[model samples]
Target: MVTTAGSAPTPGTILHLREQGFRVVATDIDPAAPGLYLADRGHLVPRGDSEAFLPRMRALCESEGAVAIVPLVDEELLPVGELDGDGLSVMLPRPGFVASCLDKYVLMRELSAAGIGIPRTWSASDPPPADVVADDASGGFVVKPRSGRGSRGVQLVGALAEVPAAVAASGYRADELIVQERVTGPEFTVSVVVWRDGGVQAVVPKEVLLKRGVTKYAVTRHHAEVERTCRAVQSALRADGPFNVQLCLDAEGRPRVFEINPRFSSTAALTVAAGVDEVAGLLRQAVTDGPRLTDTWREGVTMVRRWTDEFISEEEFASHGLAPAPTVPLVARGDDPAPRPRSTDPASGVAVRAR
Candidate 1:
């Protein structure tokens, strides 16, 4: 089972899991999520933060006979992590680690204390002393929500003086945000898969070429420093599941970690494409003893985001109790616009035009 089917990267992840011969049960708050229709089955559930979300998810797993869960969104991680027990297997880092990762300030403090390379960070309310601010005028500071993922509420300012206005414009309380010296250089999103006994399974470092909230264009690359920094993070956090490290290299080629996403990022598919199927391997380990992973993975594999359309006939749409699309025929019933190959799934009676 995977939650947040509506996310951009989920449908491809679902298809990849299915290709691995797993019966995927996708769930989302919205019924129209494309992954829902592509999965073996799907269910609509309450929002991840709602009190009712866990109960519905528990019941849905039992009803669907799902043995494991992979939460794709941050909001659902804590609640879903609690579901890990003898009966159901949940893929998440330890509760403490997850908690720390969710709060940027706490995460940086802890990692910094552990001697990991971290940007100069402080709670928004406790602004850094004027002398401590980097003298490089071109190198700005970042003001972001203390407990959120991605660049949604992050703001960049040329100096500490602009932080006040940025926070005020962001509509977040001073204490609810964090200020950090912005690190610059080549950025990489590294995936570190750890085993139950804290063994580092595989570290795949991807050089990010483009990003919009999530990575849109990335290529698998081998950077010893980046991989070394990620392993150091695993050693510090001791996360027993998969987590992604977002970092940047300074002028000296040292990796400075900026954020840690406790769950698989949208780039999980890219990891799979590069050769290590982290999701499938983790699921195997969670259910039973799994194989050991090696450090060798093909590099230079790239992933580019593209738009894909999934078409559903009016009849199949109505079967799910949803409003049907316009009844007008795409072309006149007997008129053949062009020759196109068509396929049908007998079980669901959904026909598709393949191009």
Candidate 2:
């Protein structure tokens, strides 16, 4: 299996899978994306929006004899979801599920109607319902792009009147924005792995001690309420692969979720540490016809992330094609393999025989 993206999860996954005897093909649009450095072979490819993207990606797979493609970023998910599979095994939810998750508005509506606790949300084009557009600013709201990543273009509005300008300033049209009541409570980012049969394999809800979109500091935790709520949402979405959910405890301490990500979370290393190894599940699934659904995991594990610097001299950068970045300290580093192409048995569906 070959995975794309050089983000947090991708690097750890590359390391983890490599340790399991899978060759890593690291790819990213940014040449300096640190994960690329750890790949058995790395490709600096075009952005997902480029017309050349899919064609080039398929070409990469065929050229490298890669039978599976794992995507770790949002921008690449939809396009990767469209892959016809051919002889390649790709683990993506259906396109409709991908669409619903990507569009925050739709996702919230669906979840809200499913009896999931979601922040009261408003759309730009539609005048707020009576409860949302009240003159009083009793419930503070946050406005953000309809489809966005991270905390970018997010605006806190004291009252509904402030939403319009915030939406415009956010570089999104009014209809392309969503304003929702701001949540206040300790937050948790829960990741769940599901099989194609709609069976949930595992759920890891980690308490976020600190974060910058990606988890910076976390501890493996098990809140019965949070785990229950996350699984409810997981079933509601019919999520068929690895996906993450963002939830914050409400004033009442209920785990009210606000977002769902249809890929592996940045804390893949943490999950691996916590005994819920997604890369392992994916690697096995990629090579096999199904996934194992037994639940066995370690809880109450802790993780703290620190930066690393992979400094290289100018000549080294030019000669070895180096990048100035470090592996996140929590991510494990494995011995780099000398093999040019990793082996996978298509019919048998095994990467390397369990020896």
Candidate 3:
């Protein structure tokens, strides 16, 4: 399987694919993405929005004889989805499903209409009645672009009056934003792996302990109610491949979904380290019709986040197919020269045995 972005989960993905005896090719626009060094081959590509991006990716796939592409970033998801796969598969949900997930308004409306508990969200261009916003303000309201990703443009507002300023600075039209009740409490992330046929193969919920926009600490903890809720949401969405369901528990410990990523999440490696290797599971289904992997992660496994440094000389850096990393970010702490065999261990935690 081919993976792109060459950072975080992409490196973990390359490691996993490598273990399965697949020659993994990693790509990124930035040479300093850090994940490039871990691949069988790496290439510096143009930005996703560049006109040359698509043609270059096509050429890469053709030259590498890549069977499927496992995209690692949301910005490239739709474009990658649109790639003419020929006979190769792009391990992603349908275009409509992806659109629904990316547009939080659509996802919330569809799910809430289906009786799922979702944050009360409304379009900024067409907000709710005055009294409704007043009522929601008691629970803390949030404003963000309608199609925003993660916490990029999210803004917390004390009252509806403050929304206009946030909307103005967002670089999007007022109507292009989404305002909703802030569902705050204890947050959790659910990593789900679905069969190629869109069957729910596995669900592992990790209680989020710390985060700064993205998850920094996630601990594996199984909550039956959240699992049931996620299962229901998954069935309603009919999403395939790997995706994450992020929610915040109510005072009574019930889940209310605030976000859904129709692609693999940044914390995916943490999910694998905690016990469920969603990447491996997807690869198995994508490459072969294999028996599914059941939930078998050790409970209470918590991952701590921090910056790490890897040192490489000019030759080592150029040999792996990436430009030199800037010197300032090095933090001055790593020196090693070891030539090892291709490892698919992922280096996350335990090696998941392919069933």
Candidate 4:
């Protein structure tokens, strides 16, 4: 297995994979990235240099006898797809399938062509006719870069007069921008793992918690609605591999497909916690016959951001040939007393302190 940025959130998926008994070789362009410290073997190469990076990855797979390559980052997906692993399998959908999922315009066209309900959309250059825009009951509309991800360059414009400036400032050519009728309702994410044989292996759905400025966050599981939308999206995409389909529950309580991510998404961690292990499924599909789809997800499970701080003691630091002096005091006199140090139990690495 290969992953980039080996940090929290993203690395959470890789760590889950490791717990499933798969040996992981983590690679990133930054050798000193914190995630490297967690992997069996961590490698670094020049940044944005996939051309030079591919050969090294091929060598690592050959040496380690790796069965598949799973990309955690978006940029790595296409390049890894292009690599000829020389029969060493890379666990991704067909190249065309991956591309179709990645390209928003293509995904929309395909979903629409398949009779899936989606927001009314058009190219920014050819803004909908004034009469049509006016006649639509949906008031505000969203304009965004057709190929962008992470909600980058996305705006909700309430009027047609706001579109030209929004498009101009979006850093996309007129043709690359798409204007869509903004669907008003709760947003949900449906994560589906598909096999090459056109089967839906697992479907996990999550409800999003949106704040003012932060990109939307998946905070809870909504099983009934999630299941409904997941089935709808799976049938629509005809997905072939691991993909994420996002949808909004429109005012009428109907799901409308919004965007599709071709690679693993941030929500993978939540699905794993919900007992739908996508990484394990990907590996299983790559190595053996695909596993039968099941509804094993645990609902009402919640995951919140957690922060852990570690303090290296003087003796421990010296044992590793580091300076013994403290860089920062562990406790200050007037400050709240520090808690007792907990045992460094390797299992889960979550320390338990006595009262």
lDDT values for all models:
0.80, 0.71, 0.70, 0.63
Off by over 4 Å in 3: 1-6, 129-131, 311-314, 320-355
Name the best candidate (by TM-score). Answer: 1
Which structure among the candidates has the greatest lDDT?
1
Q: What is the TM-score of each candidate against the true structure?
A: 0.88, 0.83, 0.84, 0.79
Which pairs clash in the backbone of model 2? none
Give the runs in model 1 whose Cα sits over 4 Å from its true position.
134-137, 311-317, 321-355
Model 2, span 1-355: residue lDDT tens: 3445445556666767788877777666555556666667776555565555676677778777876777776777888777746777666666777789899999999999999999888787777778755544465788877786677667888877777777777767888888888777889988787757777788888999998756789988878898888778767878777788898888889877788887777777888888877767765776675457455778888888876554546664455444422222222213212211221212211111110
Candidate 3: residue pairs that collide: 19-344, 125-175
Compute the lDDT of residue 352 as modeled in candidate 4. 12
lDDT of 3 by residue, 1-355 (tens): 3445445446656767788777776766555545567666665555455455666677777766877788866767787787735777777877777889888888889889878887777888875767665575555778887675667777898777777777887777887788887777789999887855777877889899998777888898889888888888768877766788999987667789988888877787777887677776676666666578777777798888766554657766545533342222222212212221121211211111111
**Cα TM-score of candidate 3:** 0.84
Score candidate 1 by lDDT.
0.80
Model 1 / residue 5 / CA error / Å: 0.6
Worst 10 residues of 3 by lDDT: 346-355
lDDT of 1 at 101: 96
Q: Candidate 2 or 4, higher lDDT?
A: 2
